[model samples]
Target: MTQTHPTFAEKLIAWQKQHGRHNLAWQVSDPYQIWLSEIMLQQTQVVTVSEYFPRFIEKFPTVQDLANAEQDEVLALWQGLGYYSRARNLHFAAQQICHDFGGVFPENRESLQQLKGVGRSTAAAIAAFAFGKRETILDGNVKRILCRIFALDGEGKAFENQLWDFAEILLPENSSEMSAYTQGLMDLGATVCQRKPNCAICPMADICQAKQQDRIAELPRKKSVKVQEMTLYWLILRDKNRIFLQKRPQKGIWAGLYCVPCFENGADFHNYLRDKQMDFDDLHECATISHRLTHRVLEIIPYECDCKNAAFSANFNENDGIWVDLTDLPQYGLPKPLQQYLA
Candidate 1:
């Protein structure tokens, strides 16, 4: 006998009300705080984001403050959070809020989507939390849980759009209820319907298709990804008291961050330093450090510079150089694995 499938939205929200995350520090009124949290949480786990969110919000309390801030400052706050380009987009979005939107995040979805870094999920979160709009959320967690429950089979974009259509349909009429439900779905996915989910006591166990088919883990089909390896030459300049840092172009990896110079290849790297007329005693700190992204393996060759008290440019307009105080290195952000390596 085929079972009558019931929507688990109410059950999830009720469970959320009874046993959901209530005291997250990032759940604040200021759109700036909310926006910061949304960005930090992307492609990142809640447990991981928990440590970074509050500190970031305190540093950049308002969108105006963020807009006025320098790229290095923003990127430093975003240390450990991969996808550094998102921080750049959020920074530019903040600036747009200040100039284009008059320092207030848009109350509607259309304009919010126009802002940098505010994609569907982030925009939905902001609209629901900040503006009390009834926008649906379709993050990874949500997709996993929903796919398992509905037995959605297609992979990649097909599966994603299916879930989105379902999400929009289930958005509650009241924004307050929608907000609670949205958070509830996220909470359920993160805690109960996990990667290796605990479906036995799940609210939807009564009607879950994955449970019926005994394939909970296999429901959220994803497209196969091809990982590419990119080679990088990282030139580290140190004058004992300081290390030279540079701002990456406002696009691509490590955008809006401070770090030693990086080159696409050895020849390009040598030419960069030569063009700047900088050559002194140097130390090869390590052969290479590997930083892996979702679809890329970045092999970095780290070369450390020692000036031997030889005076160089105190402050030059070199895109490849900024002398950062050693004691104040924390002010400039390093990548997560890199930070651990540094320590």
Candidate 2:
């Protein structure tokens, strides 16, 4: 509760039983669903993920189903969820679990951690939520809470591990309530002990170290990195009333999502479009969108082309591009840039 006082886990967990996210759709006995939700939640907001979670579970209800699914299909289901690697890794991990763990998700923390993309926080989440293991969690929320509560500063990759150790120390011996404790600590940071925290309702309000020091806003941060720069040219060619959409390859970024044929600045995007087999009479460059990635910033230059002298009966290659009906755009998941062009 304080820099001097100890063991805040019990109080947080106790508060959690009465005031946490209990009605979330993923709180159940199924390990696959819990694991999938945790994977999806990494660096993704719960509000965005909430819409996809139920649909995902309904589509691939079991680990084997997910494992057996085409990589593109999985990526399609995870379109717009960003951090595409999570979907890829989830598929790889499911296969491993099926082959090695009898088509069942591992129950304990150690085994779960061995699965692909199952890092410490994720492993602890699956263990605690599914098997009620008392493994402590130190996700982004917990790290922020701990860093502020201790008035801690400086970036340490090992800081989360250290915080987990502290969390374990603070955990009650009864240990029957890990699910509540883990979720509660996260929710407290999310709702009460927030970035601009409303400390009045915080269970640790009277004793939080950052509050005592009057430095709540600047407790947890790392040195900032340089943002990468990218420039893209998007060719949104349309025939009749259908706009062009291409399926990205299954390996790179936006894999399995639809896009207008695009190229980065270093590459010849105009030349690439010229090589395409389309009957276009006009090309107009629309305004650009500044697209940001975790490591790079992209300037998307959209070009609108009106096709003529072409029937709606030609097929093309090197161009996975299709003429999708604008009215039915939502039926297929296009990459964000295409969706933005439509918008």
**Highest lDDT model number:** 2
Candidate 2 residue pairs that clash: none
Which 10 successive residues of model 1 have the least lDDT summed? 1-10
Worst 10 residues of 2 by lDDT: 311-320
Per-residue accuracy of model 1 over 46-110 as CA lDDT, tens digit each: 78889988777688777888899988788788888788878889888989999998887788777
Q: Work out the TM-score per prediction.
A: 0.88, 0.88
TM-score of 1: 0.88
Q: Report every candidate's CA lDDT.
A: 0.77, 0.78
lDDT of 2 by residue, 1-343 (tens): 2233555776787788887788889888789999999999899888898999999988898999999988767876787788877888999999999999999777899999999999988998899889988787778788788877877676666765566676677655665777788788778977887667888888887768888998788878855779988787877767777777787777665766778877776357645655564333456868878888887888888877776546522543334667778887776666765676687
| Runs with alpha carbons beyond 4 Å of true place in candidate 2 | 1-4, 158-160, 250-252, 274-281, 311-315, 318-331
lDDT at 124 for candidate 1?
86
